[model samples]
Target chain A: MSKRNASESTLAHDTWAVEARGLVKQFGDNRAVDGVDLTVRAGTIYGVLGPNGAGKTTTIRMLATLLRPDAGWARIFGYDVVKEPQIVRQLIGVTGQYASVDESLSATENLIIFSRLLGLGRAEAKRKAAELLEEFGLTEAAKRPLKNFSGGMRRRLDLAASLIAQPPLIFLDEPTTGLDPRTRAQMWDTIRRLVKTGSTVLLTTQYLDEADQLADRIAVIDRGRVVAEGTVDELKLSVGTSSLQLRVQSPTDMDRARQMVDQVLGVKSVVSPEAGKITASMANADQVTDLLIRLREARIHLAEMSVQKPSLDEVFLTITVHGVKERESAAVEDEHELEVTRV
Target chain B: MSNVSITPEIRRSLKNHTSLSQSVRNSFTMAYRGLLKIRRTPEQLFDVTFQPIIFTLMFTYIFGGAVSGNVYNYLPIIIPGNLVQTVITTSIVTGVQLREDMDKGVFDRFKSLPIARIAPLAGALLADTVRYTIATVLTFAMGYIMGYRPNGGFGHVVLAGILVIVCSWAVSWIFAFFGVIARTASSVQGISMLILFPLTFLSNAYVPVDTMPKWLQWFVHANPISHLVSAVRDMVNTSAFGGSDLVISLVGAAIIVALFAPLTVRAYMRRT
Candidate 1:
């Protein structure tokens, strides 16, 4: 009972909806989720960005109380997952990587059953089921077995099921992994609506653009570790320099354009002669204007010219790739040290 | 895309969560779901209904003359035997269906809910009582149609049916344990059959124990299925619950449940 009071007081005072510290999960020889930490603020979407096998799902599972962490601890809305899983379960809803609904049951039946399990009365459960069906735009197919529904429909129903109790926090693991572009956009809208209604969300995805579009803060994970975590703009800036790209009017001017841009930017420009294009990284917005002025003075006409901010994709790639290279070099150094000791 | 407002009813439901009574209610809700699955796919009932009928007919006709000179005389022994065999074998469905549900990731959905951990497994076993009842009643009907009337009368015949259903439900806990621990549904089926085939066939269910060799007779007498079949015969034939066999059968079922129910629940908890 004192634990309940503690949780309630913490929930009122703390801005964090979910916090995980030094989480670890080992599956035999592979450290599926190595020591990881997370801090998700209330009423905002926090995204974990990673490629496959990056431990995103494992981390979510631990926070959702489905898997116990081997080392660290997590809390949802001030209730510790390990100590008070029941209270934690009460606070959070989880939509796993796969659609976890029963395919044999109709969509309406699925919703009603989940509502009942969440402590709704029979009539109330039915009413909520109908409302969720309508809300997810599945009212027309409510009576159809879930097996017949499209992938997007199933995913929507899955999300609807998690929302039946209107939990304060929701964990969506790879929510739009296999969805088509239009369906993914629709799901993003649903998520945005959910946030507007005052639900904190922890979303994990392999899509960099998805995190950039949805998350207020993002963490990039690779090989069971977080390599970088920050706002999208900060991550782009951390990777250093936007790119200055220009296309020459004629293919013959591509070499000239590349040389001039190289001299102005003090770096080699990537030249594509067939496309009459040259690209060079620039540290500041003023560099783009300076390059344009220089090109104009040299009488080099351009078909297209623009300074492009580096995409989150490039930031993520650079972070993860550099992390792997660092680890590899560290391993090499360890081996060299071992050789020296042996000698 | 307008924000969906939370109704007051939903807020109330969320606030008052996870009580013991709510767990019981949730268990029944899950059981109702299991029943719905069976209703949509009636083929799942084939083992409990048709298998019992077919096994009774096949065994009685094929071995009746050899064992007892006529099918009518053999009906007394074979009917109870078929009842026990069919009902116990039907318990394997619990584990198989559990494995199928797990494979489909339905149980993972259950894991996130605030309901009791045992609700889904308990509800699934409760819904399976329907299958056991169906097999119990059909085996008797098939027996009566085949000119095998139980002299124990209606009251005692029902007692025997109830006993078989209860015992079969207990045996299901064992298979359910297998289902939770095994890697796949097909493996659960294979492993359960490997254990059940010998228990049912090696007992004195279909034939008198005296006819077997002395060593075989020892095993036949010791077999829990033998005790269950004998208990069933005592109730259905004499209309009297007088024998020690009935006590042994009930105790055996209790022991199976006592041993495997926790094991199954523990394994299921880990997996989910």
Candidate 2:
């Protein structure tokens, strides 16, 4: 393969893998991406977490130089995304949620074409394609057209294609959004390995646990804005140390049980509109032991109860002063999180 | 190979400096990718194949006796005309396929690469030349089977084929521009046919311009396809390569390329 010298002409903003300020994109009257800013350190996996309409994809598109921002500026390894896009293009690789590999071509052909476009020699391109398919466990399907490949297989091949020359910064938008459990775990390993090998990664995901597992830091976006940004622990602490969810045995006894819960746990609870389930955040997880005893002594029977990390819904509740209408919408979004296709 | 690992510590900031020569090479590589797609699905060539054979047979027998007094006498005139008409009309596929290709997510990957922005579009247009060549050779072969012989040597016939291919390649750019801007593949085809039908049918492809009314004759002569057909006829019939008709067609092709190539590239860049 032919290698070109690293241009000394690049600017001094190379320390950070990505830096952006006031990035905005509008489609018609709706601003898909509002004035948003982000900074990603090198050799780290940064996650942008949000609901389905949170503009995470739009922000990544702007940073990858795929879409021009209507306003704002971004730089990739010291190159302006707009003014020095050619340099930016060289430094970044983007694997979108939709498989960007050609559907008509086989997996091997897709990799080779991507490699050849990056200036690899013919034989080297072939070798690289084979190696990637092998690494991605796609060697058996290398000669089959992408249309015949399953969703998990397509995702792996998509990631493989972007890693052809292994660009310094890779933007993986919802890389594991639609995969089965096994495939999801495989993708996580691949992403972790990418960072471990010295490539910085920026990934967007809707699943909170995905962000918790992979991201060193997470940015929670909602309705085209970053509502919260920090390490996952910081976000968890902001929501509360622990989440308490309980269902009462008798719907009529919910009020007494809620009162007992408030008196013992010292925290107000929000009753779900159905099933007499009460959700509350706790300052100290130890308070759960006291609340349970109070419920038992009141002769208030319980259907079920558990204390765990808060769902994304509770996080939205704590972070934003959303109205009842907005909160209902966020609850509706949580319903979607349960029905993973498991494909 | 089964033990392959992807954890190599690749140079994170591998600068890809694409010189003009590298851009050209990238375009050709894209063209090779186009050819590979064709190899996987050879049905894509059915248009170029069936159009030439079926159109040549149907047009020659149906129009020969009335237009030229006999089928035998009409071969030379009809063959060159059919070659020009079939290939120029076939150029519309370039734009249609381009629109379809861009609609897929694959082009997003292409746009993110450091190669020339125009490479994929240019490569697609270049690959369509092979389609034009297939139409040209098939039309000539079908004509020979139907008892037509070119007085001009095979060299001139090949030259005529090259001329028609060049012009059609240029005509494809206008359609490629449509492909870039039009929202759907069907719409690109719709708009291209709207523009091409009148131009191809009004030209002197199926009949002599003198047979039309005075007003119609002027338009037929002015039609760009007419200039191309007459140029091909000059080469195949009288072995005349230096005629003003050939110059007009070549210059027209050059002008179309100069105008639409960059225009299409600009539109493509904006969208991509």
Candidate 3:
């Protein structure tokens, strides 16, 4: 028995968990989720973050076996998503972006129905339903119709409903999209616990801070393609090394600070706003002291000087918006270059 | 013992996720859940209950005197015709409900679950059979209360009810395909009625087909609803059974099921 258990544990650990390559979904000429490659290792929260229409939901749906890829192959727990979809389904639970519990049915009954559908026996299904209701903090309202529940409670019920069978992988599509900040944090803790219990999760959300807070690794998708991906630190590094901020007494002092700072840092940019605050970025963290010393030596009176780590929002905007502009201009130049190449 | 218990569970779940069986099981489970929902909310029963009563009374009284010279005489023609029409028309709600469900993102949720791809569509199509049966029973009961007796006896009436329910179920599959493929519930219901109304109304429902003009008469004679109404009329009014009409009705039902089942499944597969 021990030998068999060891073999089973080894088999589970060695698998790539969920792997997809060259995924392309085309609706006519418009590519919705294009040329996406994703690998989510076992027992980690992998987040796909992007703005609306960035194909985050599309990518998650394909991974969950809802949509077939036009030009790629995908496998869940070493089983092909299309060819072995049932196996994939058994291993995973999915909570959609929308609340999907039957509105007329009571929360307890809804959970019981899904439990039975998951192949639990009648008594066992009820037991699982009760367990989930308690776990989701809805035991008091379990018998009430879901139509009467608040939005946050309904979302919790939806998540609980998905987990009745205790699936190994879960796909949560913007699970906390409309929740209050407190509820969102509580939900994040719940997700963290799921990961602790050996469940892998693939989540998609528009909130950059949510990805920064919850994801072990984040994949930033923009305009149907993955523009950047890594741990939070790695992604921040991709944008810049450090953030430099200087607060001046007046607007004139802010400009003087920028002028002195731009020369000292050798950075080509300056952002001294009308509010008498100057915040610029350096190429590296080591340049911050030099920046402050130059400002002090120039006799630029500073109220505040600080060096901070680059934020996820900064990384997101720098990578996504900048990438789009660069692509647009590159396309224009390519068109012109094409004419020149023809000439 | 542990090996015996755990391996099969894992294996069964894995098999359940990938194979076509997942789709079938998913569909059956969803249909079952829908039935449970109907149990919880009985308000949906209004259509099943009220439509049969109103239609039966209105058609039997309003058109009875002019068409057949008396209400009793009208019993033979209109009851059987109404029986066929009401049951078939009740099948339209299946498509409408499907449209509403899709609009509600029920199908969207189903797409992510890794269950059978066809389960949501198939389950919905199956659940409407209960609705079809309810309409069948209520219309027949209304017919009996109105002094329209089925000379074929209780056994034959039961057979006729089953026949209509099964055929309507087959017809609902066509509408179900439209529900999945159409943009809205109203359109699905509209498209289904646009095809059903002319076939039903122009047949032997209210007026005799022989009274119509030549071009119209030719269509009424060839209509599949005409054959079903004839077969039903022969069974209920005169206790007469064996004929080409009965054969034609069965053939029509089989053909509707055969043609639409695959098409609906194909359309449903392409939805995601």
Candidate 4:
């Protein structure tokens, strides 16, 4: 991992599919995107994981050259987004949160119109439209207007429309936000296929499982800032080790179990007497057996026990929640420091 | 999971980006899409086809006897005036439809494409010319059926029709500007109607300027709508060209296009 990081840092700017530095966007008094920086490698899926209003969409908009950043800059394959927006536009395809195809036009008509806009000849445009419709499984509904299309079908057509020019970079903003489980899986397959075709995809999603399943690298953004970024395993490991959870046979034994766990593991345990469960974080998996043996020697009855690695869901929650708390306490500390210095 | 094979021609076109001629071709393609929409939803034609027929008949019968002492005498005045009013009012759809398209995020798709920034707006305005033509022809046909005959020959009538369509197309640019800047489709329609109502009604379209109050006559004579109506009246009624009114109407349309086209494009670029 260290070696990979070193090589990534040494990669030339033109080789990176996307590079954004200190991008900021302000809407009235609200800074929708505040000092965001992103680097995406070619032919890889870079997932931006964040809750709503975390500046993921805003950052994507700026990088796609749809919205101008109030500060800083971005480059796509060494073409500056602001200075050479037309060339950058030629290189990227963007599928926004909303289905952006014309609802009044049929699926075939939508694809053909986009192809024609990309400078395709009439026969070529029609052939390409047919090919894309077949690939997206919309051949049967090609003649039907998009207003009659289901959400999944419309999204597929939207993706098909963006691929008319076969752009090297694609931006998908919450591509599966409202899709059902099956449709989301299909969409994920489509995204994987895009990457297989040598397209670099920058996707922003709020679902932790989505990033874990599809992203080569995930950036956790909270309140317009990246709070954590790494591979899924690295993110989970950053939150600390696996936890040991055990439910005592009797509610009365919960306190004893908690004390025994603290003594054996050298870490504080949280005991819930009502549920009769005691949980403690363990530094290593080998310590799990030691904990059980120590509790047994102390004659603590155990109804259940398990050691589980923290899921990416827990890591995301921990990072976002702790990030908010840290910012708030830091603000308070700054105020106190200001008072002290004034005196 | 594999990439779709691209023809060598397509690959070359993709690398060439967009030239001026390519932008114009793309704009027409967008306009063709707009026309296809109108074809599938034929009810969108009601505003151009039915509105002219209904308004010409209703206004001529209702106000003709009162304004001109007889329906026959009012035919000449009301027909041309109604043509101007109906076609100018038809221009409002350009902005309303544009706003609706923007609300549906269609412009978001266009913004990411390597096409001219003005293509969508230009295409929408171009497609609306068909609507103006329909309104112009229908207004005249309805007038002829109601016993109103223009002494102007076939050539003058065709010229008058072309003039009205061109002026309405120009007026649509202002509404397109409003469409780009307004918050909603309904608001765009509301604001356009608010601006158009006075301009259409206060002109000599329905009632002669002499019948209006002396104070109102000043605005009636000064209204650009009155100039267009007078221009149409001269061409259709007398079969004449080179009238001062025609020059004023043409200049007015040019000024509108020059003033609002850049403003609309600028606002559209910022939002997209």
Best candidate, TM-score? 1
True contacts kept of each: 0.50, 0.53, 0.33, 0.51
Q: Estimate each model's TM-score.
A: 0.92, 0.88, 0.86, 0.89
Query: Residue by residue across B56-122, what tens digits does model 1's lDDT show?
Result: 9999999899888999999999999989999999999999998888788667779888898878987
lDDT (Cα, tens digit) per residue for candidate 4, span A34-123 = 888888887889999987777899999999889999999998876678877887788888999999899988999999999999889999
- Model 3 lDDT tens row, B1-272: 01111121223324532456655666788888779767877887788888888998999899999999988888878877888899898888888887787776546656656565567777877887888788888888888888878788888788777778878888888888898899988898789889999989999888987789999999998998888889888877667787899899999999998898888878877777
Any residue pairs clashing in model 2, and if so which?
none
Candidate 2 lDDT tens digits, B1-272: 23333332224443445678877988898898888888888999999999999999999999999999999999988999999989998999999999999989999999998889879998998888989999999999999899888999799899999999999999999999999999999999999999999998999999988889999999998888898899999998889888889999999999999999999999998984
- CAPRI-style class, candidate 1: acceptable
Give the per-residue lDDT digits (tens) of candidate 3, residues A102-136.
Answer: 78789988887777666677898888888888888
Which is better, 1 or 4, measured by DockQ?
1
Alpha carbon lDDT of residue B177, candidate 1? Answer: 91
Better of 1 and 2 by lDDT: 1
Q: What is the docking quality class of candidate 2?
A: acceptable
Ranking by lDDT: 4, 1, 2, 3
iRMS values for every prediction: 4.3, 4.7, 7.5, 8.9
Off by over 4 Å in 1: A7-13, A250-275, A329-343, B1-20
Local distance difference test scores for all models: 0.86, 0.85, 0.78, 0.86
Error of 2 at B241 (Å): 1.6
Candidate 2 residue lDDT tens string, A99-178? 99899999988999899898899999999999988888899999989989999999999988888766778999999987
- lDDT, residue B58, model 4: 98
When sorted by DockQ, best at the front, the candidate numbers are: 2, 1, 4, 3
Q: How many pairs of residues collide in each model?
A: 0, 0, 8, 0
